[model samples]
Target: MKAAPPKATFAICGVTLLSFALLSATDRFADAAVLGGFIPARLSGLAVPYALPVWLTPLSATLLHGGLLHLGFNLLMLYFCGRDDEVALGRPGVVLLYVLGAYGAAAAHYAVGPHSTSPMVGASGAISALVGAYAILYGQRRPSKFSPEVARWLHIARLAAAWIAVQLMLGLVSRTQGLAIAWAAHVGGFLVGLIIARPLLRWRYRKA
Candidate 1:
């Protein structure tokens, strides 16, 4: 039986939506994005005007989205995957996973696009981490005839492959439209989710 969705999941969604509404209402959407979004170049000391301080952008970026479509897709993913994760990992664990995932996303963007000034906005990276945690926890539900360790690794490999393929395809599509997709950040966040889910699950069980 499925557990009730955790309150933190809804609260995070509410915060994201409320912040988006307020930011959009108070300034040009582009202006807010520029001011709050993660721009790797800012950390690299580029001259991008209106960019937030380098230290602030990673967390701030999670609260900004390019459009309704962007926000909607992320919130949808976050609700479903995040609910499952929260059920398994608890509220504090989910929030920690999300914050670390955002940092992971920013690290990946810095590794790949250190000099690029494009502001990376949206909750997709953090949501991708939640999806990864969900994949690890729920994807290996049935006991396999193979060794449990082998089965778990195999499941993760399949999920990772599918995720990488989809992100690559999205990257191509974004490029065609003259936009950057930050596939690296997605991969980074997903990797963090996969890595931490098991430990977080154990910690939750221990606490119980």
Candidate 2:
């Protein structure tokens, strides 16, 4: 059957296309690390004092994955989180949330990380934000009545909380080893989603 028109989001296909394009560029074009960002590239393009400077790298970096497993895992999560969200928020809202989350990730890195002119890259922050957005917006849902038949998978809050713990733990591990991990970014982005999710959902409801 032909798909019914998307209920909330606009240009849903476009967002998916762009995301795939980023994957191709980083995976195919540069042949660099795919899932994560690089120190050198993160530093280039756009600067402002004490602000989360938007850069082109975050755009592509969010799609690039480090390895097959890395990309695959994130893609699975994104499929669950992003597809629904894009459908809910439409293109503009999707873009806004993604950018905000990405920037939040970068800002956290800059704030806590020791002054290394390293380029930061990765979609974990943004994707994590998407994860966060899903958690917060879904906010304490019982499994739908059909849950036993189909949706009986997971609780939204539980998944989001678990993910947060994992990110924080990973960051601590990185810190202990003196390795460069942008754990702070994940925290920041996740928090951004948490803080604003209810409002966004309310707005969407009102808009509808």
Candidate 3:
């Protein structure tokens, strides 16, 4: 059977790419980041110069990227994991995951640094959710001496540990480079994905 096109993924990638290009070209990238990016201080009632509403910044932040490398990495992950996830969860499910992931990332970021003035940009946090869902939906199961349930949880624990380690390393690297990486947002987004993967799957195939 022929597979359905991943319209949701394509749309998201297209919009994100176009948004970055237009903002960069018009020299409004900085403005956009300040106005649209998720700022932890915004949640703490910090006023800004004509910025978007605090509640909407998380979704808006997904459309902004720091640089070509940042955008490329996110789009690539979205294309791969998103296409496959769309197949299992359908368009709505994928969109749901992405949107929820963005908010989840922002919330986590805020929790860690409520007074932070840095604006969190890029789609990585949202993409992390998709990656998390992908891990759950398609991750390989290995042979283990433990019972199936115990082994399953152990597998999740390992994945979580590995993810955190990688994020911490990335955070360290970014710190040295004078760039901030929201490792907390990534962790939060991934947790959201892991928590919702089964429910979304069941919702998709409810009639089956």
Candidate 4:
């Protein structure tokens, strides 16, 4: 049988592309980032003219990107992981993961730097959730010396550590190059994915 189309993934990518194109064309990248991106300080009563509500910024931030390269990388990840996840989780499950991931990432960022004024933009945090789900859904399980429960938790712990290390390294590299990377958001989003993957899978096939 032919594979099902990943309509939700395509729709997300298309919207993100259009948003970046419009912002770039109008030279409104900064404007959009301020108005739409998640600003941790905003949660603490920082005021801006016509800015999106603090609660909504997390979702809106996913629609904005710093540059073509930023947008491209996120879209690529979304396409690969999102498509495969859609097959297992179905469209609603995938969408739930992405949305929750964005909020989870924002929460983590705020917890770490609540007073930060920097605007966090890009779908990477949200996509990190998808990447986490992909890793769990498709990762090979190794025979373990420990009991099943202990082994499962250990596997999760290992994956989480690896992801955190990678994000930390990326953060260091970006900092050296005078670019900001939301490594905390990535870790937070990935953890959310890992936590939800099994539940969502069971939910998807509950009747089966």
Give one digit per residue, the lDDT tens place, for model 4 in 99-197.
999999999889999999999887878988998898788764688788867776677667667756765665555555344888789888988898899
| TM-score to native of every candidate shown | 0.84, 0.62, 0.88, 0.86
lDDT agreement with native, every candidate: 0.82, 0.58, 0.86, 0.85
What TM-score should be assigned to candidate 3?
0.88
Kindly state the number of residue pairs that clash in model 2.
Answer: 10
Error of 3 at 154 (Å): 4.8
- lDDT string, candidate 2, 54-171, tens digits: 3555555565443443345455666677666665665556667777887777777767753545555556677777777777655445647654424423455466668767655554
Ranking by TM-score: 3, 4, 1, 2
- Model 1: per-residue lDDT, tens digit, 33-126? 7888888878766766766777878889899875666667678888988888998899999999999889888888789989888888777788
Candidate 1: list runs displaced more than 4 Å: 1-5, 23-27, 47-50, 142-147, 164-178
Pairs with backbone N, CA or C atoms under 3 Å apart (clashes), candidate 3:
none
Error of 2 at 174 (Å): 11
TM-score winner: 3
Report the alpha-carbon TM-score of model 1 versus the true structure. 0.84
In model 4, state the lDDT of residue 57: 96
Question: Residue 203 CA error for candidate 4 (Å)?
Answer: 1.0
Candidate 1 lDDT = 0.82
